[model samples]
Target: MGKPTGFIEYLREAPTEREPGDRIRDWNEFHNPMPEERLRTQAARCMDCGIPFCHTGMLVSGMASGCPINNLIPEWNDLVYRGLWREALDRLHKTNNFPEFTGRVCPAPCEGSCVLGINNPPVTIKNIEYSIIEKGWEEGWITPKPPAHRTGKKVAIVGSGPAGLAAADQLNRAGHWVTVFERADRPGGLLMYGIPNMKLDKEKIVRRRLDLLEAEGIEFICNTEIGKDLPAEALLKDYDAVLLCTGATKPRDLPIEGRNLNGIHFAMEFLTGNTRAVLDKQPGKDYISAAGKDVVIIGGGDTGTDCVGTSIRHGCKSLVQLEIMPKPPQERAANNPWPEWPKVYKMDYGQEEAAAMFGADPRTYLTTTTKFEGDENGNVKAIHITQVEWTKNDNGQFIPQPIPGTEKVLPAQLVLLAMGFLGPEQPLLDSLGIERDSRSNIKAAHGQFTTSIPGVFAAGDCRRGQSLIVWAINEGRGAARECDRYLMGSTDLP
Candidate 1:
């Protein structure tokens, strides 16, 4: 530890954000970089606990309690405090392959399990992490170091999301030729389009890493679908091993009346189009304009919040977000212990911007959309919503029951359904004759990552369900270790 008593001496401080009203007009990131001295002080707040739980990366009460990738948080914190930045970046890269991405958008669970957070605010871990990696880039220290020798073995990865990229990086480091296949025009499956520009800059961060990967002898084939464009059998015949990292993208739908209305759309359909327009600097037919329209977004998750932010950028007239679950307590409840993931109210960036623009939070909890009402010509005009109560029924199962006389109609010209995904689309899995679990996710053991068939593996959201980017990287690295072991009868990858 740089300073044993630094935690007691300094208070936690984070980077400043641009005012919501000012940032909404542009698509650039909102965060302003913190001064170096203050960032060091923030890192000095790391307590260096005897048993640091921040790096545990385990699930507590079915919710993430620490860094999923098990980032070496304490080592980097001490390194930054001592002005040893290059060393700090090395410590960060030891566990996390992409600190920049996780630092920007990941909800930091490591801070939740911080030892100091039992009383005072936790250290500004995420901000410090972002600072370390960005500094590495500025100093020209982060560059490609290709493997020394080739093992004469090749691996085929399906999907170019975080999981696929991590696995590809690891396999390449082990001297194996790696190729990634992406269906989209871009290499980053979700990072390129699923997320908006303001949260993560595409050209600055995403493309920079892709270029490095290419320089390191990794091949990426864009606009190529494994099952549809290229048959799954091709990879089995061409490559020595195949690892499936295709994400779970099958969106859950609300099968109610007027679902086929012209104005109603899935959240991804709206988000993906908006990002394409921003990057290409031109609007196409697929672009859905929220300009001068009342928008109603169902499912109050990150996707819905993204819709809210995107709509505000498009100059929406009014907006509201609907959630079926009851609002969480503003503070941690009694049952939520110190190390458990606290279920508390949080105002994300999109909600903060909406509150600043509309003078109120846009989320309406405990409310569900019953049906969508459309006007003539099949354009959605309004939505039927009802308040509900969660109660234990006779069979001791929790169910949502609609409260009588709680129905109301809200005017909405554009309806975006942001409910979460169910599982991975089955076309590719079925074509390959891969087995799946009861949830329809590809069947693969957690640590082993081996599928039912030999020489084929699965990882990330395709194996598990929809999860965080950190978890995707973790699974990707784990799968690579197992795959390398199977191919050479022994492995050096971690």
Candidate 2:
């Protein structure tokens, strides 16, 4: 350890976020970075515990409680503590392929599984990580280092999200010719479009990384859909190995009354258009305006939070977020003790902004929408909902039971369904003749990314179903290693 008593000498502190009122006016990143000296002190707080569970990257109570990419947290913490930033970035890149993306968006399960978190708050590992990569960029230390030699083996990665990018990056570094096909207008499947511009500045972060990867000899083909524009078989005939990282994008929908109303839209439709408008400097027809209207968002996860923040930016008159499950406790429950990915309540930026403007939190827990009430023009006017309670069915599975007499209605000119994704879309999978699991995810073992088809592999959400960005990166790297082995009869990727 750099300092045996470092943990005792420093208190956990995070970078301050820009005031909600001011930040909501524009779509930009809100967190103001902490001073260099203070950040160093924060880095010094890493005790570098003997076990170091922070990098274990294992499932605890069925939730990821640590860094899934297994970042060299302690090594970088000590490096930052000693002012070896360039070295710290190198250590970080040893495991994680994209610290910048994860630094800004990841929920930091590493902190939850920190050994020190058993009693005291965990070290500011995420903040330290953010600082390391940012400093590397500011100093022009990050540069494209194309492979010294070519393996002449070609690999095609169908998807340019985190997972595909990571796999492409690794395989290219191993001297293989790599090509990434993106169905969107740009590379970065979700990073370029799905995420809000404010939370993650697209041009500054996502495109910057893409540019570097391009200069490093990775080929990117945009506006190409594998199953539509071109046949899936084209990939198999062209490349020595084919890896699929197409994310789980089939959104789960609520097929209820008035579903075809004009104001009701999928969360991606609303979010993607807003980001496109921001980038194009003009709103398009696809953009759904929440301005001067009451907005109701269904689902309480990150997508719902993004909708809240975006609606606030659009000057929505009022907002309400619905969650079918009950509110999580303010602290961990008895069954969810230390080191188990604590199930607790914490306000995200969107809710904080909603509270600031609307005078109360927007989330309503234990609720279900029964039907939609719409105006004669086919625009949704309101939604009928009922309070619900969870009870175990005869099979011992908990289900939401509607409580009668608790039915009510709320005004909503716009409704966005932020419900989670089901799995990868089926067209491409079926076209390629790849088998699927019971859940409809590509049938492939976890570490082995090979699908039912020979010389074809899968990774990320397509292989494992919908999941966090960190986990996607993990699968990508692992899949790359296995694919390299399959190609050359040996491998050396991590």
lDDT accuracy of residue 316 in candidate 1: 97
After superposition on all CA atoms, what RMSD does each candidate show versus the true structure? 0.9, 0.9
Candidate 1 off by > 4 Å: none
Looking at model 1, report the run of 10 residues with the lowest lDDT sum: 277-286
Which candidate wins on lDDT? 1
Q: Compared to the true structure, candidate 1 yields what TM-score? A: 0.99
lDDT of 1 by residue, 21-41 (tens): 999999898878999999999
Q: What is the C-alpha lDDT of each candidate?
A: 0.93, 0.92
Candidate 2 collision pairs? none
In model 2, where do residues sit more than 4 Å from their true spots?
none
